[model samples]
Target: MLRFILGLVLVVGLWSAAPVAQAQNADIEATISAQLEAFKVDDFDQAFTYASPTIQGLFRTPENFGNMVRGGYPMVWRPSEVTYLELKETAGFLFQRVMITDAEGAVHLLEYQMVQMDGTWKINGVRLLANPPATA
Candidate 1:
Protein backbone atom coordinates (compact mmCIF):
# COMPACT_ATOMS: atom_id res chain seq x y z
CA MET A 1 0.00 0.00 0.00
CA LEU A 2 2.82 2.41 0.92
CA ARG A 3 4.63 1.58 -2.28
CA PHE A 4 1.58 2.43 -4.34
CA ILE A 5 1.12 5.74 -2.52
CA LEU A 6 4.77 6.68 -3.13
CA GLY A 7 4.44 5.87 -6.81
CA LEU A 8 1.34 7.98 -7.06
CA VAL A 9 3.08 10.90 -5.38
CA LEU A 10 6.04 10.63 -7.74
CA VAL A 11 3.77 10.55 -10.75
CA VAL A 12 1.85 13.56 -9.51
CA GLY A 13 5.05 15.47 -8.89
CA LEU A 14 6.40 14.78 -12.36
CA TRP A 15 3.11 15.74 -13.96
CA SER A 16 2.99 19.06 -12.13
CA ALA A 17 6.58 19.86 -13.05
CA ALA A 18 5.96 19.41 -16.75
CA PRO A 19 3.67 22.41 -17.12
CA VAL A 20 6.05 24.69 -15.27
CA ALA A 21 8.80 23.74 -17.64
CA GLN A 22 6.55 24.28 -20.64
CA ALA A 23 5.46 27.68 -19.38
CA GLN A 24 9.07 28.72 -18.98
CA ASN A 25 9.88 27.60 -22.50
CA ALA A 26 6.92 29.56 -23.86
CA ASP A 27 7.95 32.68 -21.99
CA ILE A 28 11.51 32.43 -23.24
CA GLU A 29 10.29 32.05 -26.81
CA ALA A 30 7.99 35.02 -26.44
CA THR A 31 10.83 37.20 -25.23
CA ILE A 32 12.98 36.28 -28.22
CA SER A 33 10.10 36.81 -30.65
CA ALA A 34 9.36 40.24 -29.24
CA GLN A 35 12.98 41.28 -29.64
CA LEU A 36 13.07 40.03 -33.21
CA GLU A 37 9.93 41.98 -34.04
CA ALA A 38 11.51 45.09 -32.62
CA PHE A 39 14.55 44.52 -34.78
CA LYS A 40 12.35 44.24 -37.87
CA VAL A 41 11.38 47.88 -37.54
CA ASP A 42 14.83 49.16 -36.46
CA ASP A 43 13.40 49.96 -33.08
CA PHE A 44 16.69 49.87 -31.25
CA ASP A 45 15.35 51.48 -28.15
CA GLN A 46 12.59 48.95 -27.90
CA ALA A 47 14.93 46.11 -28.67
CA PHE A 48 17.39 47.16 -26.02
CA THR A 49 14.75 46.72 -23.37
CA TYR A 50 14.79 42.97 -23.99
CA ALA A 51 18.49 42.71 -23.17
CA SER A 52 19.66 41.55 -19.80
CA PRO A 53 21.17 44.02 -17.36
CA THR A 54 24.68 42.74 -18.01
CA ILE A 55 24.33 43.30 -21.75
CA GLN A 56 22.84 46.73 -21.22
CA GLY A 57 25.79 47.59 -19.01
CA LEU A 58 28.27 46.47 -21.61
CA PHE A 59 26.61 48.41 -24.42
CA ARG A 60 25.91 51.45 -22.19
CA THR A 61 23.05 52.84 -24.29
CA PRO A 62 20.46 51.82 -26.81
CA GLU A 63 22.29 53.53 -29.69
CA ASN A 64 25.49 51.75 -28.81
CA PHE A 65 23.71 48.43 -28.69
CA GLY A 66 22.01 49.22 -31.96
CA ASN A 67 25.31 50.07 -33.61
CA MET A 68 26.85 46.82 -32.48
CA VAL A 69 23.97 44.73 -33.74
CA ARG A 70 23.78 46.57 -37.04
CA GLY A 71 27.50 46.25 -37.67
CA GLY A 72 28.35 42.92 -36.09
CA TYR A 73 25.15 41.03 -36.70
CA PRO A 74 23.70 42.39 -39.90
CA MET A 75 21.72 39.21 -40.41
CA VAL A 76 19.92 39.79 -37.16
CA TRP A 77 19.49 43.46 -37.83
CA ARG A 78 17.71 42.80 -41.10
CA PRO A 79 16.87 39.18 -41.51
CA SER A 80 14.99 38.19 -44.64
CA GLU A 81 13.37 35.33 -42.74
CA VAL A 82 13.64 34.00 -39.22
CA THR A 83 12.75 30.63 -37.72
CA TYR A 84 12.94 29.37 -34.17
CA LEU A 85 14.46 25.97 -33.85
CA GLU A 86 15.05 24.61 -30.37
CA LEU A 87 15.35 25.70 -26.78
CA LYS A 88 17.72 24.04 -24.35
CA GLU A 89 18.58 24.65 -20.77
CA THR A 90 21.98 24.10 -19.26
CA ALA A 91 23.50 25.19 -15.98
CA GLY A 92 20.45 27.30 -15.16
CA PHE A 93 20.70 29.29 -18.40
CA LEU A 94 18.50 28.94 -21.44
CA PHE A 95 19.83 28.79 -25.00
CA GLN A 96 17.53 29.24 -27.97
CA ARG A 97 18.56 28.23 -31.49
CA VAL A 98 17.34 30.36 -34.38
CA MET A 99 17.78 30.16 -38.12
CA ILE A 100 17.97 33.44 -40.00
CA THR A 101 18.28 34.21 -43.68
CA ASP A 102 20.13 37.37 -44.59
CA ALA A 103 19.04 39.82 -47.25
CA GLU A 104 21.37 38.11 -49.71
CA GLY A 105 19.82 34.68 -49.00
CA ALA A 106 22.63 33.26 -46.90
CA VAL A 107 21.35 31.23 -43.97
CA HIS A 108 22.85 31.67 -40.51
CA LEU A 109 22.35 29.73 -37.33
CA LEU A 110 22.50 31.61 -34.06
CA GLU A 111 22.14 30.65 -30.43
CA TYR A 112 20.71 33.20 -28.07
CA GLN A 113 21.54 33.12 -24.37
CA MET A 114 18.75 34.06 -22.02
CA VAL A 115 18.75 34.77 -18.31
CA GLN A 116 15.97 35.38 -15.86
CA MET A 117 16.13 38.53 -13.80
CA ASP A 118 13.43 39.76 -11.49
CA GLY A 119 11.24 36.90 -12.67
CA THR A 120 11.56 38.01 -16.28
CA TRP A 121 13.52 36.46 -19.08
CA LYS A 122 16.04 38.74 -20.84
CA ILE A 123 18.53 38.12 -23.59
CA ASN A 124 22.10 37.85 -22.38
CA GLY A 125 24.08 37.19 -25.53
CA VAL A 126 23.98 35.78 -29.05
CA ARG A 127 26.57 33.62 -30.78
CA LEU A 128 26.65 32.82 -34.46
CA LEU A 129 26.90 29.15 -35.31
CA ALA A 130 28.53 27.74 -38.40
CA ASN A 131 26.15 26.38 -41.01
CA PRO A 132 26.69 22.90 -42.30
CA PRO A 133 27.61 22.49 -45.95
CA ALA A 134 24.79 21.64 -48.36
CA THR A 135 25.16 18.61 -50.57
CA ALA A 136 23.39 18.30 -53.88
Candidate 2:
Protein backbone atom coordinates (compact mmCIF):
# COMPACT_ATOMS: atom_id res chain seq x y z
CA MET A 1 0.00 0.00 0.00
CA LEU A 2 2.83 2.38 0.80
CA ARG A 3 4.56 1.61 -2.52
CA PHE A 4 1.36 2.21 -4.44
CA ILE A 5 0.82 5.57 -2.73
CA LEU A 6 4.38 6.64 -3.50
CA GLY A 7 3.92 5.71 -7.16
CA LEU A 8 0.72 7.71 -7.31
CA VAL A 9 2.42 10.73 -5.81
CA LEU A 10 5.24 10.55 -8.31
CA VAL A 11 2.81 10.36 -11.22
CA VAL A 12 0.85 13.33 -9.91
CA GLY A 13 3.99 15.34 -9.41
CA LEU A 14 5.18 14.81 -12.98
CA TRP A 15 1.74 15.62 -14.38
CA SER A 16 1.60 18.93 -12.53
CA ALA A 17 5.10 19.81 -13.67
CA ALA A 18 4.22 19.54 -17.36
CA PRO A 19 2.56 22.94 -17.78
CA VAL A 20 5.44 24.78 -16.17
CA ALA A 21 7.82 23.02 -18.51
CA GLN A 22 5.72 23.83 -21.55
CA ALA A 23 5.42 27.50 -20.53
CA GLN A 24 9.15 27.71 -20.08
CA ASN A 25 9.77 26.36 -23.57
CA ALA A 26 7.18 28.67 -25.04
CA ASP A 27 8.82 31.68 -23.38
CA ILE A 28 12.23 30.73 -24.70
CA GLU A 29 10.91 30.39 -28.23
CA ALA A 30 9.03 33.67 -27.95
CA THR A 31 12.17 35.44 -26.79
CA ILE A 32 14.22 34.09 -29.67
CA SER A 33 11.49 34.99 -32.11
CA ALA A 34 11.37 38.56 -30.82
CA GLN A 35 15.12 38.91 -30.93
CA LEU A 36 15.28 37.52 -34.44
CA GLU A 37 12.59 39.86 -35.62
CA ALA A 38 14.44 42.82 -34.18
CA PHE A 39 17.64 41.73 -35.82
CA LYS A 40 15.95 41.32 -39.20
CA VAL A 41 14.55 44.82 -39.06
CA ASP A 42 17.61 46.38 -37.44
CA ASP A 43 15.62 47.37 -34.41
CA PHE A 44 18.28 47.41 -31.76
CA ASP A 45 16.01 48.64 -29.00
CA GLN A 46 13.54 45.81 -29.37
CA ALA A 47 16.34 43.29 -29.57
CA PHE A 48 17.72 44.63 -26.33
CA THR A 49 14.45 43.82 -24.60
CA TYR A 50 15.06 40.12 -25.14
CA ALA A 51 18.37 40.23 -23.31
CA SER A 52 18.58 39.05 -19.74
CA PRO A 53 19.20 41.78 -17.20
CA THR A 54 22.69 40.47 -16.50
CA ILE A 55 23.53 40.82 -20.17
CA GLN A 56 22.25 44.37 -20.23
CA GLY A 57 24.48 45.24 -17.34
CA LEU A 58 27.49 43.66 -19.01
CA PHE A 59 27.23 45.50 -22.32
CA ARG A 60 25.98 48.70 -20.64
CA THR A 61 24.00 49.80 -23.65
CA PRO A 62 22.02 48.39 -26.53
CA GLU A 63 24.51 49.59 -29.13
CA ASN A 64 27.38 47.77 -27.53
CA PHE A 65 25.33 44.62 -27.12
CA GLY A 66 24.18 44.87 -30.70
CA ASN A 67 27.73 45.37 -31.86
CA MET A 68 28.96 42.32 -30.01
CA VAL A 69 26.25 40.12 -31.44
CA ARG A 70 26.93 41.51 -34.88
CA GLY A 71 30.67 41.08 -34.56
CA GLY A 72 31.49 38.38 -32.03
CA TYR A 73 28.51 36.06 -32.26
CA PRO A 74 27.71 36.53 -35.91
CA MET A 75 25.39 33.55 -35.96
CA VAL A 76 23.11 35.14 -33.38
CA TRP A 77 23.24 38.49 -35.13
CA ARG A 78 21.88 36.96 -38.29
CA PRO A 79 19.98 33.83 -37.53
CA SER A 80 17.64 32.59 -40.23
CA GLU A 81 16.08 29.82 -38.23
CA VAL A 82 16.04 29.16 -34.51
CA THR A 83 14.86 25.85 -33.07
CA TYR A 84 14.86 25.08 -29.34
CA LEU A 85 15.22 21.65 -27.77
CA GLU A 86 15.78 20.07 -24.39
CA LEU A 87 15.33 22.43 -21.44
CA LYS A 88 17.48 21.74 -18.43
CA GLU A 89 17.68 23.26 -14.97
CA THR A 90 20.97 24.28 -13.45
CA ALA A 91 21.42 25.83 -10.02
CA GLY A 92 17.84 27.06 -9.71
CA PHE A 93 17.76 28.49 -13.24
CA LEU A 94 16.36 27.05 -16.46
CA PHE A 95 18.60 26.61 -19.47
CA GLN A 96 17.55 25.98 -23.04
CA ARG A 97 19.63 24.42 -25.78
CA VAL A 98 18.88 25.63 -29.27
CA MET A 99 20.28 25.28 -32.74
CA ILE A 100 20.34 28.33 -34.99
CA THR A 101 20.98 28.33 -38.69
CA ASP A 102 22.50 31.54 -39.89
CA ALA A 103 22.08 33.29 -43.19
CA GLU A 104 25.19 31.52 -44.46
CA GLY A 105 23.62 28.14 -43.68
CA ALA A 106 25.97 27.37 -40.83
CA VAL A 107 24.57 25.79 -37.69
CA HIS A 108 25.44 27.13 -34.26
CA LEU A 109 24.55 25.55 -30.98
CA LEU A 110 23.58 27.98 -28.26
CA GLU A 111 22.45 27.66 -24.67
CA TYR A 112 20.28 30.33 -23.12
CA GLN A 113 19.81 30.88 -19.42
CA MET A 114 16.27 31.71 -18.35
CA VAL A 115 15.23 32.95 -14.96
CA GLN A 116 12.07 34.14 -13.28
CA MET A 117 12.08 37.87 -12.63
CA ASP A 118 8.89 39.76 -11.79
CA GLY A 119 6.90 36.61 -12.51
CA THR A 120 8.14 36.17 -16.07
CA TRP A 121 10.91 34.22 -17.71
CA LYS A 122 13.66 36.46 -18.95
CA ILE A 123 16.85 35.48 -20.74
CA ASN A 124 19.81 36.06 -18.50
CA GLY A 125 22.81 34.67 -20.31
CA VAL A 126 23.78 33.00 -23.55
CA ARG A 127 26.53 30.45 -24.07
CA LEU A 128 27.87 29.85 -27.52
CA LEU A 129 29.29 26.54 -28.65
CA ALA A 130 33.03 26.45 -28.21
CA ASN A 131 35.15 26.80 -31.30
CA PRO A 132 38.87 26.97 -31.76
CA PRO A 133 40.10 30.37 -32.90
CA ALA A 134 41.58 30.67 -36.38
CA THR A 135 45.30 30.26 -35.71
CA ALA A 136 47.37 32.39 -37.98
Candidate 3:
Protein backbone atom coordinates (compact mmCIF):
# COMPACT_ATOMS: atom_id res chain seq x y z
CA MET A 1 0.00 0.00 0.00
CA LEU A 2 2.90 2.41 0.56
CA ARG A 3 4.23 1.56 -2.91
CA PHE A 4 0.78 2.00 -4.42
CA ILE A 5 0.36 5.41 -2.81
CA LEU A 6 3.71 6.66 -4.12
CA GLY A 7 2.95 5.36 -7.59
CA LEU A 8 -0.41 7.10 -7.54
CA VAL A 9 1.17 10.37 -6.52
CA LEU A 10 3.74 10.15 -9.30
CA VAL A 11 1.06 9.44 -11.86
CA VAL A 12 -1.10 12.30 -10.67
CA GLY A 13 1.82 14.71 -10.69
CA LEU A 14 2.68 13.82 -14.28
CA TRP A 15 -0.95 14.02 -15.40
CA SER A 16 -1.40 17.47 -13.93
CA ALA A 17 1.77 18.73 -15.61
CA ALA A 18 0.46 17.95 -19.10
CA PRO A 19 -1.54 21.15 -19.42
CA VAL A 20 1.37 23.33 -18.40
CA ALA A 21 3.55 21.69 -21.02
CA GLN A 22 0.91 22.16 -23.67
CA ALA A 23 0.51 25.82 -22.79
CA GLN A 24 4.25 26.35 -23.07
CA ASN A 25 4.28 24.66 -26.46
CA ALA A 26 1.52 26.95 -27.65
CA ASP A 27 3.41 30.03 -26.53
CA ILE A 28 6.54 28.89 -28.32
CA GLU A 29 4.63 28.26 -31.52
CA ALA A 30 2.94 31.64 -31.33
CA THR A 31 6.28 33.37 -31.01
CA ILE A 32 7.57 31.75 -34.17
CA SER A 33 4.36 32.42 -36.09
CA ALA A 34 4.36 36.07 -35.12
CA GLN A 35 7.94 36.48 -36.30
CA LEU A 36 7.10 34.86 -39.61
CA GLU A 37 4.20 37.25 -40.07
CA ALA A 38 6.45 40.20 -39.37
CA PHE A 39 8.92 38.97 -41.96
CA LYS A 40 6.15 38.70 -44.52
CA VAL A 41 5.65 42.43 -44.31
CA ASP A 42 9.37 43.28 -44.16
CA ASP A 43 8.87 44.42 -40.59
CA PHE A 44 12.29 43.52 -39.28
CA ASP A 45 11.93 45.74 -36.25
CA GLN A 46 8.98 43.71 -35.07
CA ALA A 47 10.48 40.39 -36.07
CA PHE A 48 13.66 41.17 -34.15
CA THR A 49 11.61 41.48 -30.98
CA TYR A 50 11.05 37.72 -30.93
CA ALA A 51 14.76 37.00 -31.03
CA SER A 52 16.63 36.12 -27.86
CA PRO A 53 19.17 38.53 -26.47
CA THR A 54 22.05 36.46 -27.75
CA ILE A 55 20.72 36.62 -31.28
CA GLN A 56 20.03 40.33 -31.04
CA GLY A 57 23.54 40.92 -29.82
CA LEU A 58 24.99 38.87 -32.63
CA PHE A 59 23.14 40.81 -35.31
CA ARG A 60 23.35 44.13 -33.47
CA THR A 61 20.55 45.70 -35.51
CA PRO A 62 17.24 44.73 -37.03
CA GLU A 63 18.42 45.57 -40.54
CA ASN A 64 21.39 43.27 -40.18
CA PHE A 65 19.11 40.52 -38.94
CA GLY A 66 16.72 41.20 -41.82
CA ASN A 67 19.51 41.00 -44.37
CA MET A 68 20.68 37.71 -42.95
CA VAL A 69 17.20 36.25 -43.15
CA ARG A 70 16.62 37.54 -46.65
CA GLY A 71 19.88 36.05 -47.88
CA GLY A 72 20.31 32.95 -45.74
CA TYR A 73 16.71 31.95 -45.03
CA PRO A 74 14.58 33.17 -47.87
CA MET A 75 12.07 30.39 -47.26
CA VAL A 76 11.36 31.69 -43.79
CA TRP A 77 11.32 35.22 -45.09
CA ARG A 78 8.52 34.43 -47.52
CA PRO A 79 6.93 31.13 -46.74
CA SER A 80 3.91 30.25 -48.82
CA GLU A 81 2.77 27.84 -46.15
CA VAL A 82 3.92 27.13 -42.63
CA THR A 83 3.41 24.06 -40.45
CA TYR A 84 4.57 23.46 -36.90
CA LEU A 85 5.98 20.07 -36.07
CA GLU A 86 7.23 18.43 -32.91
CA LEU A 87 8.96 20.34 -30.14
CA LYS A 88 11.77 18.32 -28.67
CA GLU A 89 14.38 18.83 -25.99
CA THR A 90 17.96 17.76 -26.56
CA ALA A 91 21.02 18.57 -24.54
CA GLY A 92 18.88 20.82 -22.34
CA PHE A 93 17.73 22.89 -25.31
CA LEU A 94 14.26 23.08 -26.77
CA PHE A 95 14.04 22.90 -30.58
CA GLN A 96 10.86 23.55 -32.50
CA ARG A 97 10.69 21.90 -35.89
CA VAL A 98 8.99 23.87 -38.62
CA MET A 99 8.00 22.84 -42.13
CA ILE A 100 7.88 25.79 -44.44
CA THR A 101 6.70 25.71 -48.04
CA ASP A 102 8.42 28.41 -49.97
CA ALA A 103 6.66 30.56 -52.53
CA GLU A 104 7.77 28.14 -55.23
CA GLY A 105 6.21 25.15 -53.38
CA ALA A 106 9.51 23.74 -52.22
CA VAL A 107 9.43 22.35 -48.71
CA HIS A 108 12.09 23.08 -46.12
CA LEU A 109 12.48 21.63 -42.65
CA LEU A 110 14.01 23.94 -40.09
CA GLU A 111 14.70 23.64 -36.40
CA TYR A 112 14.34 26.71 -34.23
CA GLN A 113 16.15 26.92 -30.92
CA MET A 114 13.87 28.58 -28.41
CA VAL A 115 14.55 30.04 -25.00
CA GLN A 116 12.41 31.81 -22.47
CA MET A 117 13.66 35.30 -21.63
CA ASP A 118 11.87 37.72 -19.38
CA GLY A 119 9.04 35.20 -18.98
CA THR A 120 8.53 35.17 -22.75
CA TRP A 121 9.60 32.73 -25.41
CA LYS A 122 12.35 34.04 -27.70
CA ILE A 123 14.13 32.53 -30.68
CA ASN A 124 17.79 31.84 -30.02
CA GLY A 125 18.73 30.47 -33.42
CA VAL A 126 17.47 28.57 -36.47
CA ARG A 127 19.00 25.92 -38.67
CA LEU A 128 17.81 23.87 -41.60
CA LEU A 129 17.41 20.20 -40.70
CA ALA A 130 20.05 18.26 -42.56
CA ASN A 131 18.17 14.95 -42.57
CA PRO A 132 14.44 15.38 -42.41
CA PRO A 133 12.20 12.35 -42.48
CA ALA A 134 10.63 11.25 -45.75
CA THR A 135 7.25 12.88 -46.19
CA ALA A 136 4.48 11.67 -48.44
Q: Which candidate is the best by TM-score?
A: 3
TM-scores of the models, in the order given: 0.85, 0.87, 0.91
TM-score of 3: 0.91
By lDDT, the better pick of 2 and 3 is 3
Candidate 1 residue-wise lDDT, 4-100, digit = tens = 9999999999999999988988898899888888988989999999999999999999999999999999999988888888889889778999999
How would the candidate models be sorted by lDDT, starting from the highest?
A: 3, 1, 2
Which residue pairs show collisions in model 3? none
Clash statistics: count for each candidate? 0, 1, 0
Deviating ranges (above 4 Å) for candidate 1: 1-12
What's the distance in Å from true for residue 126, model 1?
Answer: 0.4
Who wins the lDDT comparison? 3
Clashes of 3: 0
Candidate 2 Cα errors over 4 Å, as ranges: 130-136
| Whole-model lDDT, model 2 | 0.81
Candidate 1 has a TM-score of 0.85
Ranking by TM-score: 3, 2, 1
lDDT on C-alpha atoms for all candidate structures: 0.91, 0.81, 0.96
